[model samples]
Every structure is written in structure tokens, then in C-alpha cells.
Target: MYVYRSHDQQLLNERVAQFRDQTRRYLDGQLSDDEFLPLRLQNGLYIQRYAPMLRVSVPYGMLSSTQLRALARVARQWDKGYCHVSTRQNIQYNWPALEDVPDILAALADVEMHAIQTSGNCIRNVTTDEFAGINGKEIEDPRPWCEIIRQWATFNPEFAYLPRKFKIAVNAVPDEDPALIGVHDIGVQVLQRDGETGFRVLAGGGLGRTPMTGEVIGEFVPWPDLLAYLEAILRVYNKYGNRDNKYKARIKILVKALGAEKFRALTEAEFAELKDGPMTLTAEEVDAMRSHFSAPAYDAIDDQPPALQDALASDKAFNRWYHTNVTRHRQAGYAAVTLTLKKTGRAPGDITDEELEAVADLADQFSFGEARTTHQQNMVLGDVRQDQLFTLWQRLDALGFATPNLKLLTDLVACPGGDFCSLANAKSLPIAEEIQRHFEDMDYLHDLGPIDVNISGCMNACGHHHIGHIGILGVDKKGREYYQITLGGRGDKTSRIGEKLGPSFDTEQVVPIIARLIDLYVEQRQPGEQFIDTYERLGIDPFKERAYATDH
Candidate 1:
């Protein structure tokens, strides 16, 4: 985790005080709704369906135990007893009072965290793979570069307000899109060739009403010109993006309208003016950022220790949790463990205050006091020891975090829809819960194999429904709630927007429809073929026909 320097602390403190006054003036009726709207949004406070929702940025999804505790405290004191993890790996408090948000921001500032740039039409949080620093296949650790981008984008007067909200993702691993970079407004692929580091930059990719994958705008942007090149891309969008209509204002629409080739030419023209300017990164600056993310002092031990093997053999439950939740780490004898937030009966991604505190304790004990939030809406202990797997599993299970459904149908991503969000067309949490309850059979799910089921209340795609292997999107039909389904979409290396299945179904029909789709997959799938593979091989017609069948 990056420790805040003196300047960083000063900036956050000043911002908190500034927002505090802004909030006070608004509450006192000194500022009009229109006047306070942008101010509140810039501070991450939103007027939701019921109360104000405050989103706190977890930069690049990283969190220290102390920061986790601060979040837990905020949840306990300000809002409900629990908070929801968003699809972007940020935290949202759904019940904060409008006047209390400033105090919440101040509290978060104490732990070197804030909500700046988390909302409004500006550069949002720069996301990356949760396993950035520890993943074995990474060409370079992306956290340092993510930090560099974060510092540059935050409070950058040039882009304080874009035509619409913009998102960026960094992927350091080769041939993988764990960060879902292909769907971000700007995707940074960290590449190394000929012993030189550079980036492959993609632009214009996004989801929502208009979902599309990005194109490679910069084939190879040298490491030194990263910031300058990024500035050029932003410059192009800021200059030409649609401001008249909110619906068609995303960079994706602009990129699509201009075409990738012409868009690239414009960006190149901008780069010609900004290249090698003051925005260019020096080697020392990169190193300084990297210093904040230096590897922890790891112990030397076998990857598969005798104790771990014995525990796996003795306890079937622990073995299941280990295989599902635990992932390989670059360091031998260490593993990255995901604390599943998709438990049945609870809203997906919702974690209680007590669970937050317990998770912080677990991180301090097992992962060197560090943890990460996944874009999939789960918490990750990124540096757990292989030998302590059983103990950690037991602790997590007691806290209801060990559901053993990583990447499975039950481990879905969803947003706080109509229940909390005013923007939603229908409720999403109930749909997610219904799906989770319908797919609770562990053996059946494991047999079905890795699948991503993403749900969103509307086309905002906050749940990233477009990328799920099976996507469920809520819709409003004659003031009634309905769900439209999509199949074969994935967020991996082969990223693509899902193809929808015919007409929408009512709330009660969603689970049975999903059951029908799963049944088709089971009956038609070959040995070792996952749900996605079967869908791709047979295409959407079979699944769509089966899903909408009268008997189903």
C-alpha cells in the first residue's frame, strides 16, 4: 500500500475542510441545488432513491487494514451497519445523511482515503488487476503506474469536467484482461519488448446504453511519454465529445462516431504538441512510485507444504474453499485468497461492519496488513501463506466469507439497484439473490464450471452485465419489472459484449429461465466444457430457444 506523503496528507485535509464548508452552505440553504450539485458530486456524495449515497475511492482497489477499519467505522456510525462494494472496486454507503458526508470524508482522510473523482463527469478511479503486484504472469507491477495516473488525474484542472464520466484500467499481465481493460474508456496494457518498457493504449471502450470494446489508439506508447500520451487522448475526447446529450456523451460514442482511425490521428496530432513536454515521466519518478509498492519480506517455504496437503486431505470443506477461493501468487508459499461477498440471502457485494472489522483483523494476521477490493465485488487477501490456508478458511467461514463460489454462477456481480439507486429501472438485488438461491448446489455449480453472472438494474451497466458469461439486466415494462438476458459475453482476454435473448421476463420468471439456460448447457456441453465454451460453440440460438421455451 502507498503511504501518503506530507503533501498528500495536506491535500486531502484541505479538500475535506473545503467540502465540509460546501456541505454546510448547502444545508443552510446558502447554495442552490444547481450550485451544490456539482460540488457534492465532486466530493462523492449523491442523492440516491432514499438517502444520500457516499462513494469512497479505493485507489486501484488497494486498502490497508487501517483503511478497512476506517470504512467499518463509517458504516457503523454514519450509514447502515453494512456497506456495498461497487463493480468498480469502490465502496458505497447507501444511507448517509447529506450533512454527514463531509464528516465521513474527513474520517476517510484520516486513513489516507477520499472520494474525490469517484463520481461526476471526470476521470474516475484508475482500476487495475487486484493481483497486480503479486501475479506471476505480469510484465510489470501496474500499481506504481496506476498511482502515477491517479496523481495526475486527480484535481487536474484540464479535465475536471469531461463530457461524461471516464474510466481507465491498467493490465500488466500478458494475454489476460483480468482488470476488464477492454471495456474501459482508456485501457493501458503494460508491455515490455527489447528490454524496454512501453504501453499499448486502447481507447473508446465502454458499456451502458452503447456497449463496445476499445480500439488500440497507440500501438506502442513509450514509458517516458505515458502521461503526455494519456493527456492527448483526453484532449481529443474533451474537444469533440457530445455535451448536448448525456446519453451519447461517453468517449465510446465519440470514438465510434469519428472512427478509430480518425480518432487515432487526432490523438497523434495532440501527442505531437505535448510529447516530451513537462508531463513526460522520468525514470526517477517511476521508481519513486514503485518504492511505495515494494514487495513484502516473504518467508522461504515450499509452495505445497506438508501441513497444507494434510489439511486438504483431511477436511473436504477446507479443500473446496481452497481450490475455489485461493489463487496462485507470484511468491512461492503465498497465495491470494478472495473473501466471497456473494452469499445467498444477502445482496451481492454487501459486507457488514462486523465483517469488515473481522476482515481487517484477518488481513493484519495473514496478508501483512494489506488487502484489495476486486472489480468483481469481493475482498482479496493478496499475500496469505500457503501453510495457514486451513486456519484462514475456518476464520473466513465463521465470518460467512467462505462461500466457495469464485467465478461460479452463484458468485455474481450486481449493483444496488432500485432499492438504493434512483437511476435504476428495477430492483437488481432481488434478482441476484434469486439467482444465487437457485444455484446453491455446490457439486452442481462445480460441475457446471467457472461462469460469470452479472446483473444490473438498468442500462447503466454498473454491474457490468455486458461482460458476464450470462448477463441479466433489469428493465421496466409498463411500470412492471422485467429482466432481459444475454449469453456468451465474457471479460477475459476474449472480451465481448453479450448477445441478448429475446423478450424480457417478469421477476418470478427470471430464476426458472436461468435454470432452463443452465439445463441446456448441462445437456449439450461436452466433457470439460464450461458454460461459456458451450454457449460459444453452439451460439445464442440454442440457449435463447431453450430459455424462452414454454415448458421452462
Candidate 2:
């Protein structure tokens, strides 16, 4: 994690003081609601369906134990007793009083965290794979570059407010894209060619009412000119993106309207002028960013030690959790373990204040005092030792974090919909809970194989429904809650938007309809096939026909 320097702390302090005055003025009628709206939004405060929701940024999903403890304390004092981890790897306090948000911001700043640019029409938190530096297949650690981008984008005068909100993601792993970069407004793929580091940049990808995958704009942007190139792309979008219709204001719409080729040409033209400008990164600057993320001390030992082997051989539950929740680490004797927030009956991603402290303790004891928030709405202990796997599993189990359902159907991704978000057309948590309850059997879940079931309460696609293998979208139908399903979508190395099945189903019908879809998948799957594999082979017709078929 990048430690905050004096200047960083000073900036946060100033911002908090400024926002505190702004909030007070708003409360006292010195500032109008219109005047205070953007001011609050830029600081990550949103007036939701109930109270205010505050989103605290977790850059590239990194969190120190001290930061987690601070969040727990804030949750306990100022807001509800729990916080929700957003799909963007940010944390949200759903019940914070509007007046206390500045206080919360001050508390977060005390621990080197803030909510700047979290909700405004600016470049939001720059996210990467939760296991950015730890993933074994990564060509390079993307976190340093992510930090570079974060520094550049945060409060950049030119892009403080664009046509709509912009999001950028970085992916360094060659084989897989755990970062889901393809769906970001700008996607960066770190690459090395002929001993020269560069980037493959994509633009205009986004998920909303107009969901589309990003297209390649810069085939190979040199390492030094990365920011210059990004500036060029943003310049194009800022100048050309629609400002008239909020629905059509995204860069994706602009890229679609102008076409990727013309957009690339525009970006290249802009880049040519700014290629060697002040924004061009130097070796010293890159090294300084890298210094902030030096590798942790590791013991020289081989993986799968005798203790780990014994635990795997002896305990069925530990083996299951290991196979499901744990991922291979770049370092030999270490593993990355995801603590599932998608436990049955709980709102996906909701962690209590006590649980937050427990996670902090776990990080301190096992993961070098660092933790990560995953885009899947889970927390990760990224540096856990392979030999201590059993002990860690026991601790997680005690905290109800060892769910053994990673990538399984029960491990679904969803947003806090009508329950919190005023923009939501219907509630999403109940439907997610219904599906989880319906498939609570671990044997059946594992047998069903890896499936991404993303649910969104509206077309905003906060739940990333467009990218799920089984996508459920809540729709408003004549003032009634109805859900529309999509099949064969994925957010991986090969990303694609899902295709709709048929008409929408009411709230009561959603779970049963999902059950029918699952039954159809189980029957049609080939030997050792995952749900996505079967969906691609069979396409939407078979699933659609069976999903809407009447019971005999």
C-alpha cells in the first residue's frame, strides 16, 4: 500500500475543512441545494432512498489494517453498525446522517483514506485485480501504475466533470483479466515487448442501459507516454461526449457514435501534440511509485508444505474451502484467500463493524497487516502462508467468512438496490438471497460449476449484470417489480454482453425461473463443463425455451 506523504495528508485535511464549511453552509441555507449537490457528490456523499450513503475509496482495492480499523470505528460511531463493500472495491456506509459525513471523511483521512471522486462525473477510483501484485501470471505489478494514474486523475482540472462518470481499470495478467478492464471507460493492459514496457489501451467500454465492451484505441502506448495518451483520450471524450442527454452522455456512446477508428484517430492526433509534454513519466518517477510498494519479506520455503498437505488430506471442510476460496500466489509458500461476503441471508458485501475489526486482526496476524477488497464484494488476505491455511480457515469459519463458494452460483454479485439506492427500480437483495437459499447445498453448488450470477436493480448495471453468465436485471413494469434474465455473458479474457432470454418475470417468479434455468443447465452440460461453457455451446435458445416453458 502507498503511504501518504505530508502533501497528501495536507490535501486531505484541506478538502475535509472545505467540505465541512460547504456542508454547514448548506444546512444553514447559505448554500442552495443545487450549489451543494456537486460539492457533496465530489466528496462521495449521496442522498439515497433513505439516508446519505458515503463511499470511501480503496485505491486498487488496497487497505491497511489501520485503515480497516478506522472504517470499523466510523461505522460504529457515525453510521450503521455495518458497511457495504461496493463492486468497485469501495466501501459504503448506507445509513450515515447527512450532517456527519464530513466527520466521517475526517476520520477516514486520519487513516489515509478518503472518498474523493468516488461519485462525481470524474475518473473514479482506479481499480485493478484484487491480487494485482500477488497473481502468479502477472507480467508486472499493475498497482504502481494504478497509483500513478490515481495521482494524475484525482482532481485533474480538465476532467473534474465530464459528460458522465468515467472509470478506468488496469490488467497485467496475460491469460486472464480478473480486473474486468474490458468494461471500463478506459482499460489498460500492462505489457512488455522486446525488453520495452508499454501498454495496450482500450476506450469506451462501459455497462449501463447502453452496455458495450471497450475497443482498442492505442495498440501500444509507450510507458513514458501513458498519461499523455490517457489525456488525449479524455480530451476527445470531454470535447465530443453528449452533454444533452444524461442517458447518452457516456464515452461509450461517444465512441459508438464516432466509431472506434475515428476515435482512435482523434486520440492519436491529440497524443502527437502532447507526446513529450510534462505529463510524460520518467524512470525516476516510476521507480519512486514502485518504491511505495516494495515486496514483503518472505521465508524461503516450498509450497504445499507437510502441514498444508496434512490439513488437505485430513479435513474435508478445509479442503473444500481451500479449493474454493483460496488462489495461488506469486510467492511460493503464500496464498490469497477470499473471505466471502455472499453468505446466505446476508446482503451480499455487507460486513458488520465487528467483522471489519476481525478482518483487520486477520490481516495483522496473517497477511502482513494488509487486506484487499475484491470486485466480487469479498475481502482478501493476500499474503497468507500455505502452512497456516487450516488455522486461517478456522478463524474465518468462526467469523462466518469461510463460505467455500467462490465463483459458485451462491457467490453472486449484486448491488444495494431499492433498499438503499433511490435510482433502483426494484429491490435486488431479496432476489439474491432467494437464489442463495435455493442453492444452499454446497455439493449441488460445486457440481453446478463456476457461474457468475450478477443482479442489477436497474439499467445502471452496478451489479455488472451484463457480464454475468446468468444475468438478472430488475425492471419496472407498470409499477410492478419484474426481472429480465440474460444468458452467455462473461467478463473475462473474452468479454461479451449477455443476450436476453424472453419477457420479464415478476418477483415471486424469479427464484423458480432461476431454478429452472439451473436445472436445464445441469441436464444439458457435457462432461466436466462449466455453466458458461455449456451456455456458449448451446446458446440462448435451449435455455430460453426451457426457462419460459409452462409446468405440465
Candidate 3:
């Protein structure tokens, strides 16, 4: 994890005080609700349907054991005993009091974390692959670039209030972690051609109402000009993005209205002014930033320890978990482990304070005092030695964090929908839960292979329904809650928007319809085809026909 320097720490401390004063004035009636909305939002406080939801930024999803402990303390003291992991690698407290939020921000600041720029029309938290430095597949660690952007965009006066909320994502290996980079307002793919590093910059890609994958504006902008090129894209968006209607305000709309070619031309015109400007990243500066994220000192061990082999041979359950939740590490003998947050009866990403504290402890004991949060609402122990995995699994299993459903149908992505958010048309948690209950058979799920079932309470797409292989969007038909189904959506390097299956189904019919679709896939799929591949081969016609059949 990156340690905060003196300047960064001071900035966070001062911002907390500033927000505390603002909060006092708002509660004292010195500031009107209208006047205080932006201030509160800037601090990541949103007044939801029942209570205020405070979103805390976990930059690039990195967290030190100390930071994790701080988060646990804050949740215990200020929130309901747990916090929800958001789709953008953030933590959300859905039950914080309006007055206590200042204290929450102050607590976060104590650990070099803050909610600044988490909401409002600003550059939100910069997110990337959870397996950035440890995973062998990555071309280069993207964390340094994420931090550079986080520092640059943090309170930039020009972008504090844009046409709408802006998001940026980067990936070192776009081909490997395809979903992380494709669905952001600005997406960057870092590449090294020859010995020179550069970026493939894309702009105007986004979801919610109008979902579109970003278009490439610069195929290869040198490392020195990365910031300038990105700034140019933001400039174009700020100038032309629709502000007349909130519905049409995102950069995606702007990109669609002005075609890709025209938008690229406008951005290039702006880039001409900033190519060699002050914001151009320098080699020395990048190197200095990179030093903060260097790998930890690792101890050597065998790739497949006899102890691990013995444990796998003895325990089928542990074996199942090892096969599903463990991933290869860049260093030999080390492995990256995904801690599943989706326990059967619990909300997809909710973590209790005790479990969080235990996770922090596990990080100190097994990993290098650190763990990273995943965009799919999971956590990663980035450098666990394979030999210690069995012991770690036992500890995590006792705490119920070692579920073996990674990449399976039961491993779902969802948002706090009508249960908490005022923006939602229906409750999403129940739908996700019902689906999990309907398909709890481990063998059935394993046979089905990897699939993403994402549920959004509304078209706001907080759960990224636009990118799920089986996307479910909640709708309000008249006054009743209904779910609209979509098929063939993906958020990878080859991104595609999903198409509607047919009419929306009542709330009671959602799970049954899903079961029908799953049954259709299992019955008709090829030898090694996953759900998405099978859907691509067979199209939605067969699934739709089977799902909506009279008997079903």
C-alpha cells in the first residue's frame, strides 16, 4: 500500500476540518439545504431514502492493515456495524447520521483516506485491477498512474463541477482485466512499444441510461503526454456535454451526438495546446511515484507445498475454494486470493466490522499487511504464499469469508437498490438473493462455468447491468416492481451493450425466469462454452423463447 506523504496527509486533515465547519453550519441552519447540497456531496454524503449514505474513497482499491482497522473502527462507531463495497471500489455506509458524517470523514482522514471527490460532478475515485502489482498477467503496475491521476484531479478548480460526474479507469493489461477499463468516462490502456511507454486513451465511454464503450482518441500518447491527452478529452467534454438535461449530461451522450471522429478532432485540437504544458508527466516524477508502489520483500517457498497438497487431498471443500478463489501471482510460489464477500444469506458486498478487522489481521499474518478491494465487490490478498493458504482458508472459513463460488452464477454483483437508495425503482437485493437461493448447488454452478449475473435497482446501472452476461434491471411498471432482462452484455476488451429479451416480468417471476434461462444454457451449450460464449453462439432467441414459455 502507498503511504501518504506530509503534504497529502495535511491536505486530508485540513479538508476534514473544512467539511466539519460546513456540516456545522448546515445543521445550525446557517446554510440552506440547497446551499449545502454541493458541500455535503463533495464530502461524499448523500441523503438517501431513509438515511444518509457516506461513500468513502479507497483509491485504486488499495488498503493497508492500519487503514482497514481504521475503517472497521469507523463502521463500528458511526455506521450500522457493516459497510457495503461499491462497484467502483469504494466503501459505503448506508446508515450514517447526517451530523456524525463529519466524524466519519475525520476518522478516514486519520488513516490517509477521505471522501473528497467521491460524489458531485468531479473526477471520482480512480480505480484499476485489484491484482495490479502481484498478477503475472499485467504489463505494468497501473497503481502509480492511478495515484498520479488521483492527485492531479483531486480538487482541480476547472473540473470541480462538470456537465455531469466524470470517471476514469486504467488497466495495465486490458486483455486480462477487460471489464475494469472499458466502462469508464475516460479509459486508458498502458502499453510499452519498444522500450518507450505510452497509453491508448479512450473517451466518452459510460453507462446509466445510455451505455456506450469509449472511442479511442489517441492510439499511442507517449507517457510524457498522458496527462495532457486526458485533459484535452475532459476539456472537450466540458465544452460540449449537454447541461440542459441531466439525462443527457454524461460524456457518453456527447460522444454519441457528435460522432467519434468529430469528438476525437475536438479533443486533438485541445491537445495541441497542452502537449508540452506543465501537466506533462516527467520521467523523474513518474519514477518517484512508482517507488511508492514497489513490491514487498517476498520470502521464497515451493509452488505446490506438500502441506497444501495434503490439505487439498483431505478436504474437498477446501479444494473447491482453492480452485475457484485462488489466482497466479507474478512471483513464483506466491498466489493472489480472492475473499468472496457474497455469502448466501448476506448482501453481496456487505462486510461486518469483526470480519473486516479479521481481514486486516489476516493481511498482517499472511499477505504483506495489505489487501486490495475488487470492482466486483470482493477483496484480494495480493501476496499469499501457497503453503500458508490452507491455514489462511481455515481462519477465513471460520469467519465465513472463504466461499468457493468465484466466477460462478452464485457470485453476483448488485447494488443497494430500493432497500436504501431513493433513486431505485425496485429492490435489487431480494432479486439477487432469490437467484442465489434458487441455484445454491455447487456442482450445478461449477458445471455451468463462469458467468456474471448483475442486478441494478434501476437504469442508473450502479451494479453495471450494462456489462453483465445476464443483466437484470428493475423497473416500475405503473406502481408495481418489475425486472427487465437483457442478454449478451460484456464489459471486456471486446465490449458490447446488452439487448432486451422482451417484456419486463413481475417481481415474483424473476427467479423462475432466471432458472429457465440457466436451464436452457445447460441443455444447449457446447463442450467447454461459458454462458456468454454460448449466448453469443445461440443468440437470445432460444433463451428468450424458453424463459418466457407458458409452462415456465
Per-residue lDDT of candidate 2, residues 462-495 (tens digit): 9999999999999998898999999888986666
In the range 435-487, model 1's lDDT, one tens digit per residue, is 88788889989888899999999999999999999898999998999999988
Q: Candidate 1: which pairs clash?
A: none
State model 2's lDDT.
0.93
In candidate 1, position 273 carries an lDDT of 96
TM-score of 3: 0.98
Candidate 3: give the clashing pairs.
none
Error of 2 at 467 (Å): 0.6
Candidate 3 residues lying further than 4 Å off, grouped into runs, are none
TM-score of each: 0.99, 0.99, 0.98
Give stretches of model 2 more than 4 Å off: none
Task: Look at candidate 3 and tell me the lDDT of residue 54.
Answer: 93
- List where candidate 1 sits over 4 angstroms from the true fold: none
Better of 2 and 3 by TM-score: 2
Cα lDDT, model 3, residue 328: 88
